[model samples]
Target: MRRTTAAIAIIAISVPTVPLTYGRSQVGGARVKQYQEHLRTVLPEADHFVSKGGEYPHFRGYIRGTAGEVDKLVGLAYLNSDVGHAITGYASEIVVMVGLRPVGTITAVTVVTHNEPYGYRSIDLARFKNQFPNRR
Candidate 1:
């Protein structure tokens, strides 16, 4: 039974399930605008952006329009986080919003939210996010 359960779990995860906004309660429409604003800090050249597709565990699909329809793509943006906590010990999810170039390199990453220790958060946000603009 254990082996069967494990196999089922693996198959369930391996199969590409059409992401139905995993945890709909967690991702709201507001996060779309939030991520778009975050994306602008990295992709000012995109000109137009829209997040209309479903959200996944770490991926958000969006439409990018640049230099007219000829240059277009249904880009997948990433919003992820490192786990940390405040002094009180509650889990604080740090959400990092990021976009990728067509070649699969990171274009930019913005730290969107966190509940880190006050002092550490105050200084680390900018420096940490600044590193991912052109990384792969």
Candidate 2:
């Protein structure tokens, strides 16, 4: 009876630990690398990004030189979920990363993630995505 109780306790402790470790690994894994690529796609001019803290968080885009970042601000990039929490697609939320010039012109908009059933035929198309860039 004591052995059985000890085994049960060990299983309970180990089960939760596995998921926590897995979750942390994922944060630093392929998905994060892909998202960084997405950010670069939208804000190609920015060689470096600095997170700006606010009620709605955003990245201040900058061009890094041999010394460091240039004083001139290039653009801004942010996720839609940070500003538009209530927006959702058919299956789930459609997260987008938007880049803008200093003058507020949209540089580009890229869909970071979406789960809509027919999204590939529409939202994933270059024609649809192309419309956002250069827009106010």
Candidate 3:
């Protein structure tokens, strides 16, 4: 007999309705680096990120080529807000970053920030985040 487990990549927490303020002109170079660091946690194979615009805004993660140029597409990273989801947690909206493979499987999910009081304890646990990886 075989047992199967289903994992939903979506997770909710709490966050304020504010646009991201991470840009070279707004928050300085260090802030951008910090944001990228967060992104790397979900898409470790990505070495370069390019912002893509559309109904579902996302970042195209790419890997560097042999000659030190970014040429291969690795995965896509996007925030829940980009998909226009009104999903909220205990307090408010939960901002989460999700990395997905081209074949529609989830690579990983990372909670960028949250405003949950009690929920934080559970959401912050590694096991909670670990369950999201390799799921569809």
Candidate of highest lDDT: 2
Candidate lDDT values, in order: 0.56, 0.70, 0.69
The backbone clash count of each candidate, in order, is 0, 0, 2
TM-score of 3: 0.68
Model 1 per-residue lDDT tens digits across residues 1-136: 9999999999999766543332333344544554567756655556555444343433334445456556455344655531222123234645666777767777777766665666533536667877877778
lDDT of 3 by residue, 4-56 (tens): 22222221222233435531222323333556966798788988877766566
RMSD for each of the candidates: 9.9, 5.3, 16.2
Candidate 2 structure quality by residue, lDDT tens digits, 22-87:
122233234334457876888898776666546676767777655664456789877777666645
Rank ordering of all candidates by TM-score, starting from the highest: 3, 2, 1
Cα deviation of 94, candidate 2, in Å: 0.4
Instruction: List ranges where model 1 is wrong by over 4 Å.
Output: 1-31, 52-71, 81-91, 120-123
Please give the range of 10 consecutive residues that has the lowest summed lDDT in model 1: 81-90
Name the weakest run of 10 consecutive residues (lDDT summed) in model 3. 5-14
Name the regions of candidate 2 deviating beyond 4 angstroms. 1-34, 65-69, 119-124
